[model samples]
Target: MSYIDGFVIAVPNANREQFIRHARTFDPIFVEFGAIRVVECWGDNVPDGKLTDFRRAVQAKENESVVFSWVEWPDKATRDAGMDKVMKDPRMNAAGDLPFDGKRMIFGGFAPVVSLPD
Candidate 1:
């Protein structure tokens, strides 16, 4: 089974283009480091919930939008090693200034319990 790294972020709406450019520049590094795929999704219909919601999870402001993204890896070992290399890779420093607030981002690694059409 594949390993997954999921992320949710709040990005200022005005920075949408900057965010895409940033992703395009850096997302490929994950592939070079062994990630099978990287997907970034800009929120389209995310709604507020009475108790909890994606918006509140990252404390998204009125001027911001939620971004849901993930990375697919062959397995945990590969993901761990690749992530280490990614951090040490020099190209990471080339992506100047994050388009979103890193402090408000939420991320985690997940093991799939169920997948469709297997």
Candidate 2:
């Protein structure tokens, strides 16, 4: 099975364009680093949930709109290796003025339970 890294982060409405710009800059690097897929989506339909919900698992913030994303890899080892390279890549570093709060970002690795075709 493939390895997946999931991320949910608060994004201010005003900075939506900035966030998309950063994603566009990072997407190709992620692919070049061997990520099989990179998916990014705005928080359009998150359900209301408590703090405990987010602490226990991936969930949107109550007062903040979010960007939910995932990156897929062949396996854990490959994911780790690719991430190391991605982190060191200069293009990734150039995204320094990221529009969102890095501290408020929630992320993790997940083994997919199911993935349906669109």
Candidate 3:
């Protein structure tokens, strides 16, 4: 089974283009470092939920929109190695004043509990 890192972050609506530009700059680095896949999805269809539902999650703020994304690797070891490389890459050295609150970003590593083929 592959290893995966998942992320859910609040991106300021106004910075959407800048956010994507940053992500695009990193895509090649990730691929060269052994990432099998890099998938990024904007939160166009996120359904209302405790964490995402504005009325329920007190933390949900007005200026931010959700960004759900993930990266896939052959396994945990490869993922870790690739991430280390990614971190050391010169292009990633400075974030260049990102638009959102980094502290508020949520992320995790997940072993796929279930997946169905198309």
Candidate 4:
């Protein structure tokens, strides 16, 4: 089974293009390191919930939009190894170059439990 890394972040509406550019700049590095696929999604229909929601989860502000993204890996071991390289990669270490607030980013690793077309 494949391993998944899910991410959600709040990016300022004005930084949409910057965000895409940043993703384009760095996402491929994940593939080079062993990710099978990387997907970045800009939220268009996200809604607020009474108590909690994607927006609230990341403390999204009125001027920001939510982004949903993920990386697919062959397995946990590959993901772990790939991620270590990703973090150590110099490109990812550029100072003050992130398009969004890193503090507001939410992420986690998941193990898929089922699939529709197995």
Give all candidates' CA lDDT scores.
Answer: 0.97, 0.79, 0.78, 0.95
RMSD (Cα, Å) of candidate 2?
3.2
lDDT (Cα) of model 4: 0.95
* Top candidate by lDDT: 1
**Candidate 3, position 78, lDDT:** 92
lDDT of 2 by residue, 1-118 (tens): 7889999888777888888888888888988988999999987766556655432344334445767899999888889999999999887877777788787788899887776761
Residue 44 of model 1 has an lDDT of 100
RMSD vs true structure, all candidates: 0.7, 3.2, 2.6, 1.0
Clashing pairs in 4: none
lDDT of candidate 1 over 55-115, digit per residue (tens): 9999999999999999999999999999999999999987779999999999999998887
- TM-score, cand. 3: 0.84
Off by over 4 Å in 4: none
Better by lDDT, candidate 4 or 3? 4
Index of the highest-TM-score prediction = 1
Q: Rank the candidates by TM-score, best first.
A: 1, 4, 3, 2
Better of 2 and 4 by TM-score: 4
- Give lDDT: candidate 4, residue 36: 99
Of 2 and 3, the candidate ahead on TM-score is 3
How many clashing residue pairs appear in each of the predictions shown? 0, 0, 0, 0
